[model samples]
Target: MSRRSSRRSPAITSTSPCPCGLGETLGETLGECCGPLHAGSTTAATAERLMRSRYSAFAVADEAYLLRTWHPSTRPARVELDPAVRWTRLEVLGSTGGGALHAEGTVEFRAHLTDAGRADVLHERSRFTRVDGQWVYLDAL
Candidate 1:
């Protein structure tokens, strides 16, 4: 098994609300949503799905999934998420040209987190593109 597969994902249940905050909005649990994406059993069909799964990866500290979904041209050697910062919520503000028919797209979002009891938001408009017909994150705008 590869290092990514060997690494255990954070334990979550089928009924548990997804960290990406899609559970309440879309009625998708962790198991029914980002879990398969992170497990490599499925790939994101749209840029927004990729974006949301990346946020869920951050929330669960799954660096493997993050790196896997990143475009190789810009993918880092490794990802190190701050353990002190808890990703709490995701607010996808908007998106453009990220449909199933588009080759490139952008997603604007606000990720809310709390570090040492202090809350903060990281707002960014991120870019995505298809490589070999798979959606991958490119960069932030």
Candidate 2:
């Protein structure tokens, strides 16, 4: 096995601070933040929140959550998460629309990660849409 697949990592704890950098000051835990979204117990009210939750899912390697929250129009048959990629941080740069009253929205962010011992960042402005009143990822701009 490759180095990344040789080790098993626990994703999150109820008390662990959120990986998406949310509550950076108040210190929000994953259980109190994205955990609910990941569990299907709740849905994001805004596009930005969905964006954060998506980042958190990547950090935790919750491929199911990622695929579930992806818009069907753009979703792939499967999402193959690389164990070698360790998502580290998220920075929400800006947003447009994607509110409760809007059907579409866009969020810009910088997702930092370490891949195979190399540090890199994925920066993009992502689009979101409401399908059946639930927020789902559409694509990147």
Candidate 3:
């Protein structure tokens, strides 16, 4: 039988400072606010928060967080944000639209991961929307 990979790894140690700059450790930073998004702007701010949280989810394989923030239309029925998928970096190319209560925004990022001792790159241009006063992931290209 083929052996599938485990999707949850041991928690980060105190000695390890997080690469995302959220905190000294992974668990400590999951919900910690990093940029302006932490305070709540209703539009751009929430989008920013979602972006950061998604990255954090990728780093820790927090599938629950991913689903919670995803718009129902685009959210996958199920996701395997594998813990074995070693996240390497995150970058926000540009963002726009804080004018209306209901608005759209874009996030372009490059995610790096390693699987089976080999590396892979996932580059995406993602769309987000403000729904019911929260930012939700819509789709990714």
lDDT of 2 by residue, 1-141 (tens): 234322224755657788878845557788888889988999999999999998988877777788899999899887667878888889899999999999999999999999998999999999999999999999999
The TM-score measured for candidate 1 stands at 0.89
> lDDT of candidate 1 vs native?
0.86
Measured against the true structure, the TM-scores of the candidates, in listed sequence, are 0.89, 0.90, 0.69
Cα lDDT, all candidates? 0.86, 0.85, 0.59
Alpha carbon lDDT at 15, candidate 1: 62
Clashing pairs for predicted structure model 2, backbone only: none
Q: Give a tens-digit lDDT track for model 1, residues 22-118.
A: 7678898987888899889999999999999999888777788888999999998988776677788899999999899999999999999899889
The lDDT, on a scale of 0 to 1, for candidate 3 is: 0.59
The segments of candidate 2 whose C-alpha lies over 4 angstroms from its true place after superposition are 1-11
What is the per-residue lDDT of model 3 for residues 67-128, given as tens digits with 9 covering 90 to 100? Answer: 76789888777676554567766655666653345478777767676876679877788888
By lDDT, rank the candidates, best first: 1, 2, 3
- lDDT accuracy of residue 106 in candidate 3: 75
Q: How many clashes show up per model?
A: 0, 0, 0
Error of 3 at 9 (Å): 3.1
Task: Evaluate candidate 1 by giving its C-alpha RMSD to the native, one decimal.
Answer: 2.7
After superposing all C-alphas onto the true structure, candidate 2 shows an RMSD in angstroms of 3.5
